[model samples]
Target: MRSCWRSAVATRSSSISRPRPIGDARWRRAELGAQPDLTAYRLFHGDAEGAPGLAIDRYAEVVVVHADSAAVLERWLPEIREDLRDFASAYVKVHPRRASRLTGQDMQQAAPAAPLWGLGVHDVEAIEGGVRYLVRPDAGLSVGLFLDMRDVRAWLRGNARGLSVLNLFAYTCSFGVSASLGGARRVLNLDLSRAYLEWGKHNYRLNRLTLDERDFVYGDAFDWLGRFARRGERFDLVIVDPPSFSSSPFSVTRDYPRLAEAAARVVAPTGILLAATNHAGTSDERFEAWLQNGLTRAGRHGQLAQRWHEPSADFPLAPGRTHPYLKVRALVLD
Candidate 1:
């Protein structure tokens, strides 16, 4: 796909005016229809797919749009909704304005959000790669599921069976859910938020999977990593997906090499580790270097088993780019 970053200017007879690409409408529709299990997808990737300033997503019957530029997004929201109003409802989320310049109080006020049309519902069920997950349409800040991690979830399901898995920074335990769905013998989800972990339990329930309180842990990932390292607790597959910045007692490492070192300590001698960062600024090469440095610090001569990236059709990328905002790298510790 070509770069969709055109500066606020109008598309010259391009699909931008239509929001969801008319050219790919049939293909998009067919893709969504064919995959009943994987319902959530990028109906239109704003700025990158075609519609600048707007990112249209589907959660089963509901459609969610997140736009960075309300000024530009406002004009197309209606037409976009009308052209494809066959389904349920529609919603739009405005990007928080120039956060860099906003004061702390001002920062607290988030971007505006409202339902454009259709029935606005919260309780919605959806699937991805045949895996069931919940979606809360009212979560203007988030749509419950991070669709970009679709490939990562699939990878966990395939590689985690029969292995003890540890998912750190597990938001809503999506990775853990996928691991259990894939048959992981022992899966542990650790996160700072208890509410999300509880939500994760709900997800487990949806899949008819058993849940142990011991398995769903609540704490700082870094702190627990230290405890697990000292206790000689090891996992065959360790997943470390951290947010950009963490607050309170748990401060995430800006030092990538240090993070890698901490992550390796919890991995079994013959284990596989998958670490990812969603920070768009971090290139794949830079992230890999951090991973390599972590291995060096840990004194573990690990092989770069596999490198991962966004693979679903919805999260398309431009050519000649190292990483598409979200970067993931996997390794085998020897």
Candidate 2:
């Protein structure tokens, strides 16, 4: 009887010990095709990959594991650390489903201050397409940069030459930095958070780009857009990438059309406007309709120059899903 019980326990342990097949094939492909200077990317997209409630990202020497709950994070963290043994450090960040109910102390308790594996090195640099941006693995919710927008930044770098660019909702100004590197004549980064604007300046200095205080605007995007329109200021390239939901009066479902109309007003004739949303609930058809309505209201006619979705290789859609969460369209306004 004792021997049988021991065998049963062993069998269950063995079954649960194996690591989920995450980052194996993807890492191999990345290693083979990766540029020498690029170092940051999504190692595992949990919802689409084998791991349903967890995702992993690499930033230089550190690896961040994001989970939907503390229990899920703790359960799989050991296996993930073993699987990514080559990484210098690993940190786990739990995003509770009902975050609105939790207090600051509850969140702090959920995500411990210490690293799960190796030394606690929170701050690091993430290089993508040869442009460097600062990242903090231990930062709550989001580190300085959003890995999913890597392709969009790359596109801006390649196409922004000689254009005057305006980047709205510029968290840390990653898009502005990309535009600067791409040789844009001028780049204006607008955001509600002054601290983020300062961080953007640090990014500019990191790339050895010149600093002009006027270029970093600190105000609400809607107000600034109105002011720009009144002042007859226009941009050759306008980027509108607002958060899906924010404390401000912005809701992707309800306000996207209004936002689009405001953005279209400041686009120079024949200029390019890149509008994007990462709201999984909003369908592509609905999003496009909102853009069309906004354009029509603003009296601007345009053609969709390019439509970009999330990079499929790294961010594949989950099972039974037809489209990825991110949707971006570049319109050439006339």
Candidate 3:
């Protein structure tokens, strides 16, 4: 994988004209196809794979092409669709540079409701490490599961046996599902959106796991963490994976330390805390500092157990970058 990254960097420096052709992406796809159980993965990482601002992901029989702008989508979509002809459907999603200024409706309008090529099927099941996840290709910005978090989910599935897991900011409860499947004694998912919690239930059902209504909690993560701390309820494993930026107090840059402190209160002594963020601007050193500050303020001593990054096969780091946009750290609290 390091060779892949270096080669990509070399290719970038060597060429100044047309971007790499779809054949390169096709080669990567063929390599990924060897894994029978996994059906969802990034086929092309635009930032590192010669196609800037353009990425392609495959979910089961569906292929999704993400372009940073309308022009990028228009430029690469046809060739990508042709290159991935084995897929049943193909869809395009445009991400404008000034998307932050656009309203929700405006963003939705940027993506087509129907497939740009092939069948009209939108809803599909994506399998990763033999776990089934419901994915809708035509659904607005995200398709239920975050492909970059695939390795994290797989790690949880292997390590959660007999542990009581608490998943904070559990969008669609993917972590909860993975933990439950790994034979965790109990798993509680807390999120701000009731609708997303319900969607999480659907994910649980897709895996044929029994769903307990009490396990799905809908509320602000900070508020719930406070309540859990007050009630003296602790978990053996706590997962904190929040969005990079949200309204007001949920901003990662400004509030992650507070969130980490609150989350630490509910982690049992000797338990593991897995904190993750996808903010590209925040370097790893600063993120670890934030975690240390929060743990020190909480009066808990801990050691860094492990660090996880995005799968390099699908998410190669850009030239000279030491880490990807996604950063995950595991701390063992004493």
Candidate 4:
């Protein structure tokens, strides 16, 4: 597959034709499409914040497009439609400006809900954490799935069966879903938002799993971890995927190291701990230091297992930009 993708890209490049050859964007698209699998996976390359607010996703035989840019809707739609004619079936998902006016206390709070006009229908099967879920993309800031964590999820699912799992900073409980699918006997999800916990329960329901069996604790994850330590509760597997910053009385930078310390106390002797961060500005070494120091301060000893990367080939960070999104590193105490 790698060679095929390389060849597909190289076929368009020529050293003999001119002194300097211009790279074609179509070749990039072809490379993206010629990956391991392209079913139910599509690509869209338009500015989300700029003039062109165009999005395209393939669902079954249909290709859904959302044209929020006026110029693209008026001028480029015909060309885009013609180019996409060979791609199964195509349809437009409109995101009119007036239909998406969000008003709240602040700009961040005023932003419209995530589903912003691209196929408002619910229950799309998005793969994450080795589980296929009927998720609603428009539900919240999260699309019910974090496709970016695909690789990390796969690794955990394969290794976590029969383990007592703890998922902190659990967003719609995708990791818990994957852990459950991976045959975990006991799973605990901790989050501050009860609404999101409810959504996580819905996601579990979508997979025909019982949430009552697994513990869903609604409280500050840091506080819960401290309580877990006091109670001498231990887990075999722990996944920490927290947001960059939250108003939930817990700031990541201020709270992450403390969280790591708490994690070390609750982790079993032979357990595996995953401390994942999406802060792209922090280097890999710094992230490792933070975790290692926290564990040491908490009087826990663990060996570094592995540093996981994004499963997809498309790297999200530009080299020049400071991206703190480091991969999830697994630490083994055994």
Name the top lDDT candidate.
3
| Candidate 1 ranges beyond 4 A from true positions | 1-29, 97-114, 245-253, 319-322
Model 1 scores a C-alpha lDDT of 0.73
Q: Over the stretch 1-334, how does candidate 2's per-residue lDDT look in tens digits?
A: 1232233334334546553455353443354135567677777787877778888887877878889887778777666865666677877778876554567787676566688778987678778888989887766667788888888899889999999999999999999999999999999999999988998898898889999999999998899999989999999999999988676767789998998999999999999989999998888999999999999999998799988888877677899887778899999999
Expressed as tens digits, the lDDT of each residue in 266-311 for candidate 1 is 8998898888887767887788888888888888867777777776
Off by over 4 Å in 2: 1-19, 23-34, 98-102
Q: Which scores higher on TM-score, 3 or 4? A: 3
> Residue 132 in candidate 2 has what lDDT?
86
Backbone clash tally (model 1)? 0
Going through the candidates in the order shown, the clash numbers are 0, 0, 0, 7
Residue 288's lDDT in candidate 2: 96
Which predicted model would earn the best TM-score?
3
Say which prediction, candidate 3 or candidate 4, comes out ahead on lDDT. 3
TM-score per prediction, in order, is 0.85, 0.90, 0.90, 0.71
C-alpha lDDT values of all predictions: 0.73, 0.82, 0.82, 0.62
lDDT score, candidate 4, position 8: 34
**Pairs in steric clash, model 2:** none
User: Which pairs in model 3 have colliding backbones?
Assistant: none
